[model samples]
Target: METNEVFEKVKGLFVEDLGIDESKVTMDAKLEEDLEIDSLGIVEVVMAFEDEFDIEIDDEELADVSTVGQAVNLLHSKI
Candidate 1:
């Protein structure tokens, strides 16, 4: 998948599942700091991504992914 496609799908996941404003779901937006997603919410987001992309994301793989761009890059790489 293209980087932009990954970004858009991840952005949609954030907006739909987390109720985040699309305008604030920028490439640099921090998942915890900017989006205020708690630990449980993070798990939910991860699961949602796994379902949406039909890919598996282990916890270790997500340990350092704190930003939207980072998550997009990870997903892109997996695809």
Candidate 2:
């Protein structure tokens, strides 16, 4: 999938998993500060991404994914 499409799907996961407003889950949004996603929340998001993309995300990569755009780009590369 394209990066933009992956971004939108990740945004949906943020909404579903975190109860975040869809409007606020933009590409540049910081997962922790903007979306209030804690470490556990990050784990949940990673798991959701793994399921959605059918790819495994390692801990080091997950640590580096601090922004929505980063997640999009990472998923894009994997896809």
Candidate 3:
């Protein structure tokens, strides 16, 4: 999938599942700090991404994914 596609999908997941404002789901938005997603929420988001993309995401891989851009990049790599 394209990077933009991954970004859009991730953004949608954050909006639908986490109830985040769609306007705040920008590439630079911080999942924890900006979006106020707790650790458990992060895990759930990761799982949702995995299911959405049909790809496995290890915990270690998620360690550095703090921003929407980072997550989209990771998803792009996995795809």
Candidate 4:
């Protein structure tokens, strides 16, 4: 899938599932700092991504993924 496509899905997970504000879900936004989502919330969003994309997501793969763009790039690569 294209990066933008994966981005929209990840954005939706943050906006819908995690209850994060839509405007804060930008590519450069930090998942924890900018979005104010806790670690557990991040895990839940990642799980949502795994389910939606039908792929396994290794949590360790996300250790360095602080920004939304990085997460999208990682998930896009898996797809």
Candidate 5:
């Protein structure tokens, strides 16, 4: 899928599923710091992404995915 498509999907997951504010789901927003998603929350997010894209995401692969852009890029690459 395209990067923008992945971004929109991720944003939807954050807003609809994760209960994050829509305005705070920007590309530069930090998933933990900016969005207030803790470790468990990150796990929830990873699971959500995996389910949405029908792909599995390794925890090791997500080591450096700190921001929304990084997550979207990772998912886009996977898709």
Candidate 6:
């Protein structure tokens, strides 16, 4: 999928699953700062991503992804 498609899919997932506000979910949004996603939430996000994209992301690589754009970029690179 394209980057915008990925962003929209993940954004919906975050809103439906995490109860994140739509206005707060932006491309530059920081997972911790904007979404208030804690450690467990991070894990859940990763899991949701894996399920959404049908790809696996190692735990080590999770730290490198801190923004919505980063997640889209990473997903783009992988899938």
* Highest-scoring model, lDDT: 5
Report how far off residue 48 is in candidate 2 (Å).
Answer: 0.6
TM-scores, each model vs. reference: 0.95, 0.91, 0.95, 0.91, 0.97, 0.93
Which clashing pairs does model 5 show? none
lDDT (Cα, 0-100) at 65 in candidate 5: 95
How much is the lDDT of residue 72 in candidate 3?
94
Q: Is candidate 1 or candidate 4 better by lDDT?
A: 1
Query: Would you list the clashing residue pairs of candidate 4?
Result: none
- Clash totals in order: 0, 0, 0, 0, 0, 0
The regions of model 2 sitting more than 4 angstroms off are none
Provide the lowest-lDDT 10-residue window in model 4.
37-46
After superposition on all C-alphas, the RMSD of every candidate to the true structure, in Å, is 0.7, 1.1, 0.8, 1.0, 0.6, 0.9
Alpha-carbon deviation at 44 in model 6, angstroms: 0.4
The local distance difference test score of model 4 is: 0.87
Give one digit per residue, the lDDT tens place, for model 6 in 2-41: 8898889989998998899989999999999889998889
Q: What is the lDDT of residue 25 in candidate 4?
A: 90
The 10-residue segment of model 3 with minimum total lDDT is 38-47
Better of 1 and 5 by TM-score: 5
Query: Over the stretch 1-79, how does candidate 1's per-residue lDDT look in tens digits?
Result: 8999999999998898778989999999999999989898899999999999999999999988999999999999999
RMSD versus native structure for model 4: 1.0
Taken over the whole model, the C-alpha lDDT of each candidate is 0.92, 0.85, 0.90, 0.87, 0.93, 0.90
Residue pair clashes in candidate 6: none
Q: What does the lDDT read for residue 59 in candidate 1?
A: 96
Please, what are the lDDT tens digits per residue for candidate 3 over residues 1-79? 7899888898889899878999999999998899999888888998899899999999999888889899899999989
Q: Can you rank all candidates by TM-score, best first?
A: 5, 1, 3, 6, 4, 2
Give lDDT tens digits, candidate 4, residues 1-79. Answer: 7888888998888888878889989999987899987877777877888899999988789888999999899998998
